[model samples]
Target: MTEPVRLTDIAELAKVSEATVSRVVNGKAGVAAATRQAVLAAMDQLGYDRPARSRQRNAGLIGLIIPELNNPIFPAFAQVIDRTLTLRGFTSVLCTQSPGAATEDELIEALTERGVDGIVFVSGLHADQTASRDRYTRLITRGLPVVFVNGYAPDVKAPFFSDDDAAAVQLAIAHLRELGHERIGLAVGPSRFVPSRRKAEEFRRLMAPVAGEAEVERLLVNSLYSVEGGHSAASFLLDEGCTAMVCGSDLMALGAIRGARKRGLSVPRDFSVIGYDDSPLIAFTDPPLTTIQQQVSSIAAAAVRALLDEIAGLPVPSTEYLFQPELIVRGSTAACPSS
Candidate 1:
């Protein structure tokens, strides 16, 4: 049996009056949609069953495919997307990829078999330069609505949303340069990924004026997007006499800090480091990380809107949408020790 609804508890939780709660509970017509949702959410939270008439009917199922949650940024994206879908009356099916797990193709097949209305891809195979575009083409040809985040495949006819990788690299380089660092190293992920390629290209272009083309190439280190990868890259860059470093992710930045410490060096005192993706709780690290922040909420909302438009048979431009990233300064970076 369901518990009795408590008007005071629900109203307080939803931040509305008892009358509003009563109206929502009774399925009254005057309450705004947002207000109704708030009331319903509050009721759900308080362990009260919503009146059958007030229950929401799901609009459709949206397939959300992303990388493993070990990376904090991926979860942040997933959470925003999931909440937005729920608010829009859509059910979201989250699919994650990892080693020994289902591949992207397999996940798509499963979601399609289950009759999802559309799909959202976050840093999936669409982002890999080496991956075939045929998979995406086939989906579009079948009249299925799809949207991509953080990756672009021009051959694939769909809306793409991403953070400006080149701009992020430029901002980090400029900040480090202002701190009087002459020899700065870049630690990024594999070149096959679109983001990594963009950052590397920009790093080479910007550093060319300072280090020259050939020497700038040596300053760029390709590694995994993990702490261990950052550590290994840091060791090599340190050997190259780099006084400051720009990392591809917060995880890598942490690894670089660890690497510096292992060599008996203090962060920002001996070496300055900048990271990408100002992910949650990063500001609370040993020496807070200075990073480029991706606009996750804006990107997620835009991608969801584009997918819904495509589902509604509305025209959406088949081009990439780039969102600007902000540079967040913290304790991880400082003036060059030698300067």
Candidate 2:
């Protein structure tokens, strides 16, 4: 037999009074929905199974599809989303994919077969400009509640959550310019992804005032979203007299540091780098990385609210919700060389 649940434990975990926990646990009618959700989330966090009487209160299961867990940012999004769903009495089913692993289509098929009430996709196929949008179109036609994150497709009739990619590039440029770095360059992901395209276009637009439009293209390098990709892009830009570089991710920034070291140069002394995605451990790196912070918590909350509205048969507007990004300055960047 399972151990009896304790009201004090739930109260402490939920940061609420024992009386409130008592009301929620006993299924009393006066407990506020917000308080009840906090209690449920606390119970889930503590691995306490709900009382048998409360089994019927579960909202439903939600499928959360992500590109991969290799990047710290993806897991960061997953943790907040899972916690939010549990608080609202919904279960989260996480699906991850890699280059050679289960394709996105396979994951979607499995999720649909399992009768998931709704789906939340993060950096899925919808972000690929070259990919067919028919998959998302079919889901909309079937009336399934879905939300996309970090990617936007005009043809997909679902709510989209994305960080302002163009603004991020602009922020980096402005900061580097203030540091007297005239030969600034960008190292971003492949051109096929929506974010990559936006960053590139914005970089060119801003650089055109400094360098002609044709010369701006020479300072931009398209590569993978990895450390090696950053190294390669940085190497090319450095050879072209670039004293500072902006990378698509922190991993790339670290790689760019390595590239600078290989050429017998010290970071912030001979070169400076800025990265995107202020992930959890990024601040603790060798030289705490300067990065663009995506408002993951707010975006995840908004995405969940939209999905819940759709699930509840409420009128949810199909529009793109853009979250502003903040640029975090740290030790990895410095004034340009005076040589």
Candidate 3:
């Protein structure tokens, strides 16, 4: 048998009075939804079982489809989105795609069959220039409420939330330039994805004035958004005599560091590196990374809000919303060695 829940213990943990805890525990209607959630959370944290009547009935199910969880950035986004949905009384059904796992279409089909109230896509095929947008069109045609994150399709009628990829690249380049590094390179993902394309284009436009068109082309390297990809791209850039590089993701940055070390070079002493998506635990890496921080919390909250509005039959403009990213300077960068 489960131990009884002590009212005083819950009140103190939840920062509410005994009466409030009692009301929440007994399933009274007076407590605010957020407060009730808080009480329930406190009970869970304290290892106390909730009263059967106090359990909340989920308002509806929301499908969240993301590329993969291997990348820390995706998990970070998932946590925020899931928490926000829970607070709003909705249960989030997360569908993740991997090399041999179910495809996006398969996941969407399963979600639709389950009668989800809405859906959110993160870095999905909508971001791939080569992928067809007809799948999204069919969903919209069926009156399904959907939202896209980190991708934009001009013809797709949905609200999109994305980081300012162009701005991110510009910021990284400007910072390296200010450090007197003229031989800067860009290591990004495949050009087919929207974010990679934006970053690469901005890199070319900004570096053209400094490195000329021909040299700028040599400075840009397209690879996978993985550590191995970063390592390969960095090897090529290092051979091109690039003293600094701006990577598409923090994982790539870590790989670049490994590659530079393999070439008998010291980071920030012989070469400098900057990364994007300042993912969790990146700051704890040896010589904590200097990276661009995507506004994950803000972006996730905005995406959830827009999705809820659509589900509520509110008029939501089908336009892309770009959130600004911040540059987090750390130990991974310094004045160009020759400077």
Candidate 4:
């Protein structure tokens, strides 16, 4: 007894190409698990027979490795990278690194073992000039198309995308200077990272003349990119008699505000704080943080496009593509207390 079945029925049921269904039904390869499931669902809905021994496709998966998903900034970037990859007909495998967990090298090796088409790294070891570059060179030797985001190693042969940290600090300093914040302070991450070094250098240059020698020393504080780091850095700034603070991240800025309140100080009154990376939900925080907004979509899209272009044998620009951040004025920052 022959059952009633047609390609159109299978295609409509699976919501996929008749070719995909045919590939699955004929025990062929190159179909994704999720896609294969969709086809199977469609067949079941249409009461079609099951395939004998269908397997999933492993060819189109791309690896996206990022550092520390706890920060909103990293997650925001990851989301964009994932969406952009999916739109390009590639399945994304997001690998996030945490303390004592999977290391970047291990993640890369695993992804490669799984036969990823390419790799995208965000805020990885490339940002640290002190870190070894042999891993990157080895990947290059292995003929893998790797793209870097928010980290640029000049010697590494790959397309890179990042925010202009110097310009970001300059923008923040300019705004504070305009507001008559003569005794301004800075709270940023460690200087080992390229972005932090650029920010610190630009800050010193800008503060050298505008602020006095004692004030300049008081104005700079290095710490982690967290709320607690911000709290401690702001405490130092306050102890040094700083009236305003410029932080490296929105999370740090929030911490600065907390530090001030702990001492019975009011933001924009007793202390003014500015933050970087105007990530999602930052505006909804108490007093609404004034921050520098990273061009996430543009940067993410550019990185993916560069990697895909390289994968397709197209010429990718070897230079770093730096996107400038915009300063968003919000309630967290205001006129200096003297004004």
Candidate 5:
């Protein structure tokens, strides 16, 4: 092993006293568990080799594949999953993909080669109706333990965990309607994704009682699940004279707010906006967003538990587990404005 890193460096990095760092390094008693953990984390962060006594044998490697980290919700899920997995004695290797980065297939192949004990997929290709299901089938054939989040593939034999997309839309619609808003529009991602399709279908069904089915389509806008996408969709909804809007993600809701402000409209006054996934810091946004809160921790824990069961050679039936979402009222929604 290389020369031991300086105690002062570890102490400064961990924000602990030098004596505390020395005690942790020397494996001395009397240190709080949390403090020891903090010192060790600091050592790891500082590129220091842990003393033999402080080293832990990893339970196993698990792969966590996600679409992208640009959105806060993905990171939120990652944090919870990572912490839970670590607490369970497993180490997680997170792989994130974007337009041109490593694709899901590439990451899967790499993880498989590395002999990962299990894999977790969040909002992956399994959620896209148009994507081929053969990839997941091959994994099942190889007897690899896998868990899917936020998407479902009937043909893929794996445990699936998802937030109730339909219920979320219903809640958003009901909240807006209770506020006396009739012309509420839905802004969501493309219909190719299962969650987006569910939201769109439910939105149409719920609004049919208010406006005819034909007008429902007019109020629905399918676009990317990004801020720019939300902004563009909100612009179109505004053109349709929508007084309230529901978005698929918090990023989109912020984008809608931006689009409204661009037109000199104030939120919850001239227009009301509701978003899905009450991501971190969303409550601190201007006119704090009213949104649907996904049970992220619960879903993550269930996904980990299901995967662990499969890894232990226990029979885990492949099925969809839906967690209910709740509507959190904030400054972004209010009674509909009177003409």
Candidate 6:
């Protein structure tokens, strides 16, 4: 080998001191496990091929494909999945899609080509009812370990992990109803997505009595799962005298807030809004959003574990695993204007 490497170099990469690297190098064994891992990771990151005799193989890699990162919820899920995978000794490679760049199909091909031991698709095309199911069937036929999240397609042989969208809507409606809001509207993404579809269907059923013909018609607004969409949808509902709104995503809720403000009204004071996903940064919002909180930690863990189970040839339940969402009460909701 070349002249003995300096301990200081490893310390810098590890963000520790030369003494810490020395301790790890000498195998004295008093280093905190995290610190030891840092030093070891630093070595790997530096491209210093460890002496063959001292090298250790990694557990394996998993490919995690997400739709986009603009929405905070996507990154929140990414963080949880990444940490959970790393802790379980699996390295997760996150591939996020850009507007016009590589699509999910391309990402799937790329990951499998690189030999990822398994893959977890979060809010991917698998969740799109219109997308061809053959793509997933092909992967299944090839025996690639895969898990689906936030959507269910029975034709594909993979475990589906999703939050209870219907239950989420039910909770939002009950919260508003209890607060004395009679004319409540559901602002959601297109009806194509599974979650949106589930919410819309449930909302109509739950509001049928309190929300009559003309009231319900003007109340249901189909908007994109975005802020602008929320703004636009809320504008229409506001004209119909809707005093409460349930949005599909936190971003849309932010948009709805903007919508309410445009009409010279304040949130929870002029109108009550509820959002889904409880995406990161929402808690810090101006009024803080009252939202249906997805049990992200549990959902992420279940997805990872299910993928691993599939990889080992162990059979996992094929049914959709539904986790109930809890409603987080924050400043965004309150007694209806009249109540």
> Relative to the true structure, how large is the alpha-carbon lDDT of every model?
0.94, 0.90, 0.93, 0.87, 0.92, 0.86
Across 142-223, the per-residue lDDT of candidate 4 in tens digits comes to 9999999987898998889999999999999999888888888899898888888888888989998987555676678889
List per-candidate RMSD values in Å: 2.2, 2.7, 1.7, 6.6, 4.4, 5.1
Measured against the true structure, the TM-scores of the candidates, in listed sequence, are 0.95, 0.91, 0.96, 0.83, 0.87, 0.85
lDDT of 6 by residue, 1-339 (tens): 766557778889789988887776766656775676678778777765555433224689999999789998889899989877765667899999868989888998999989999999998887778989887888888999899889899888889999999999999999998999988999988877888888888988888877765567668988998899999998988888889999999999999999999889999899999989998789999899999999998999899989998888899987899999999999888788876
Model 6 quality (TM-score): 0.85
- TM-score pick, better of 1 and 3: 3
Reference-based lDDT, residue 117, model 6: 93
Better of 1 and 2 by TM-score: 1
Candidate 5 wrong stretches, greater than 4 Å: 1-50
lDDT of 3 by residue, 217-286 (tens): 9999999999998899999999999999999999999999999999999998998999999999999997
Q: Model 6, residue 56: displacement in angstroms? A: 6.4
Error of 3 at 105 (Å): 0.5
How does candidate 4 score on lDDT? 0.87
lDDT of 5 at 103: 85
Worst lDDT 10-window in candidate 4:
50-59
TM for candidate 3 is 0.96
Off by over 4 Å in 6: 1-56, 213-215
- Model 1: residues >4 Å from true position, as ranges? 1-5, 27-30, 44-52
Candidate 4, position 140, lDDT: 82
- TM value for model 4: 0.83
Quick one: best lDDT, which candidate? 1
TM-score for candidate 2, residues paired by index: 0.91
